[model samples]
Target chain A: MTTVPRRDRPGFYYPKPPATWWLRRPNYVLFMLRELSSVFIAIFLVLLLVQIHQLSQGPAAYAAFVERLRSPGWIAFHVVALAFALYHSITWFNLTAVVQVVRLGERQVPPRLVAAANFLLWGVVSLVILFFFLLGG
Target chain B: MSTRKTSEPFWWGLFSVGGVVAAFLVPVHLFLHGLAVPLGWIPVSPARIQALVGHPLIKLYLFVLIALPLYHWAHRFRFILEDVGLHALRAPIAVLSYGSAVVGTVLTLWVLLR
Candidate 1:
């Protein structure tokens, strides 16, 4: 159960891929981009935490934070972050079909249907958030 | 080469759950908070958002939204570091990445509840 795949094993040729291997193939490029997406998302969450902390500091502080957020630099950062976030969502849902196998009695649901269900749920969740943001007053 | 009990599964579970959260929830938030509201496209009164953030349910949502994806980032960033030729330093990388996530989680709780 504890098999180690270390180099220098007898009769084994361990190939260490170069750092740029991910750049070689289009899928590899996208795969690397997908992994990189979380970093951006994490960065956004940290910004959210800063915004929340500003809110805790009271109205003026929160307003200051909002003003800073409205600056062109922050807006541009967000435009990029939104792009990465969308890529994350699309790739994540696409992979869910492969990872989640839904079963209905004796029949297993098709992978496309599973992914489609996830997309439907994704849309509904998005709409709910939009509602809370725009019209939940 | 140190024989440590692997905590891989625990981290992996968090990664998967965090991935789900990021995929399902991150875009709308990013779009609204990062772009729309900030750009003044969707008018939001400061007091309304203030009240919303103070609500217990919204606090819970914020905690989930901000904290879990951090773990996902930690896990993936660990692999990314290894991929980028830091394989020898993976143990330290794992500690650093996941430790930051833990710190982020604690800070999230403090900000939300305090």
Candidate 2:
């Protein structure tokens, strides 16, 4: 059975979106930014691992690295990375509401409730981290 | 575009788990070490931070935090590049992306163990 390929036939124009298609809509841009956030977060992890490696080297090396971080450029980078990481977390939690649907008896749990729960958990976890810093132990 | 492969689910499974881990843990880590201590918002010293990292539980936490997110980033970045029209290099992109994550995971474990 010999069949002609669809693309080989006439009038089969499949439009390809431009590279900047994300700029076409606000939501699309947001989605792209959310995806891009992972890169910054990964970079942060690598730097943290490097810091850990420095810690293993000696106190002097670790202190030097920490001292270097006091520069304005590093601070600005951290600020931007913080924004991206927070955005990534929020978007990921909201996505959980869509991905996991729970049913109680005959009624399904509302997505808003799910999202709220996620935010609440996030808040609690953040507070616990803050508590550690506050307790200084 | 090339068709999806059977192995996609396996890689995607890692990506999903990584996303969940990153979403829950990453922000808090950034807020504490990345922002607070560095900015002088928290009065913790480097020795204190080092001792915390020396703890077994924190080491394990760091391992999971650093390793999984690499894969998550790899998967997302691969798709983004492809969607933006790097379809011809899909196979190579997948290899490069996932390879970096694997290398990252190894580096994380080695550092934590040391």
Candidate 3:
């Protein structure tokens, strides 16, 4: 599935790929998994919306929501969601070099340096948010 | 297909912006809210968090955080469907994919702004 099968012309060849084509190759499988990460992240967003709604219902409702989230099932779901969120973040940040090019004078920076810079920024941002969450309040 | 005439670039631009936003922010948000607060790593107080959420800057931040990554998901998920042999159903799938993101974005706005 590297290249899409174009629309079949009158006499041209366009092989009909099976539904399981992505499963045949490890890279394709990995790609599909990465795409799938969005689904989990989107669901996580919906859960967040629900959480905010709970908060809007005042302290008691928010506390009840937190209590429900503390259950084993919700905690397990969160674990999986966090795993996918990390996967999405790592892959997205790793592609920064390919997607964005930085220049020093007339020369382009090395891809490794670009990727490293992204990772470093990610760490700083994560630390700041963590600080806010853990202590700012 | 004339790419210039259509709105693909607009969505792609959003996808790129959303990619940057999600890559930088989502992981930390997930870690703190999903695991830390729930599992007792960080203290979970409803009033404290509510107070934080009530701030205008935090409300705007929340709106951006929840809305942008949605477009990223929509664009990627659309291509994923196309690549996996659903290229024939491109029209409806594109609608459903982006339409859901649009809905999610509206929902986010309603929740955050309210």
Candidate 4:
């Protein structure tokens, strides 16, 4: 007598399905965060353009624009957007080393070095800007 | 050996050039807005802004700074998305980024001219 293999049998090959989407795949969460941060960049540009328009109009319009930016609602918007921008900056900087290729003969520069350089450059730029601002130049 | 072409050179070139330009322009921008005008160091008149923007040299500088940074940013963002496993969306992302850069440059030029 030939025995038929059980179609409903569950063994090591396939025991049970994943409990949830998160359990099945975890990277999607980070992907969503990164993509969502792009919205802040768009928002920032719009804010800047509006400010430029106000400046072009005249002093009164510019003053109104500045006042609007200082409002609670705008402040809150900027705070949230700033957080997103920080996240974007961190992630983007981390990727810089990976994307850039530097080779000295057969030896390649490390990615960490690239990332470090980028951060350092940012620091220097910030300092210069601060200096110029403080010096009233 | 089948040689694989690497994108590293292009990326490095872009970042290097951008880094240098940013190092210079950012300070000038900050000074103009923060110290020069706000602190009453260099005078905070609207006429100053108009004059600065009207200068041919300053206008050219602004154009380069705006256009190059936009291009660099768009390229970087496109690659970042691709690296994160969104290969299918690369075409659309590239189009959107480059298109926005071009539009932005045109708009900025119009504003400056007016």
lDDT of 3 at A47: 82
Greater lDDT among 1 and 4 belongs to 1
DockQ of each: 0.76, 0.65, 0.74, 0.12
Better of 3 and 4 by DockQ: 3
lDDT score, candidate 4, position B57: 76
lDDT of 4 by residue, B62-99 (tens): 66655444545555567566554455466698778767
Q: Which pairs clash (backbone N, Cα, C closer than 3 Å) in model 4? A: none
Question: What i-RMS does each candidate reach, in Å?
Answer: 1.1, 1.6, 1.3, 6.9
Worst 10 residues of 1 chain A by lDDT: A1-10
Show model 3 residue runs off by greater than 4 Å.
A1-14, B1-4
Is model 1 an incorrect, acceptable, medium or high docking prediction?
A: medium
What clash count goes with each model? Answer: 0, 0, 0, 0
Q: Which portions of model 1 miss their true places by more than 4 Å?
A: A1-13, B1-5
* Candidate 3 colliding pairs: none
Tens-place lDDT per residue, model 3, A1-137, is 24444554444445657878899889989889888888778777788889998999988898787788889998898889888888888888778787788899999999888888889999999999888877865
What range of 10 consecutive residues in model 1 chain B has the weakest lDDT sum? B82-91
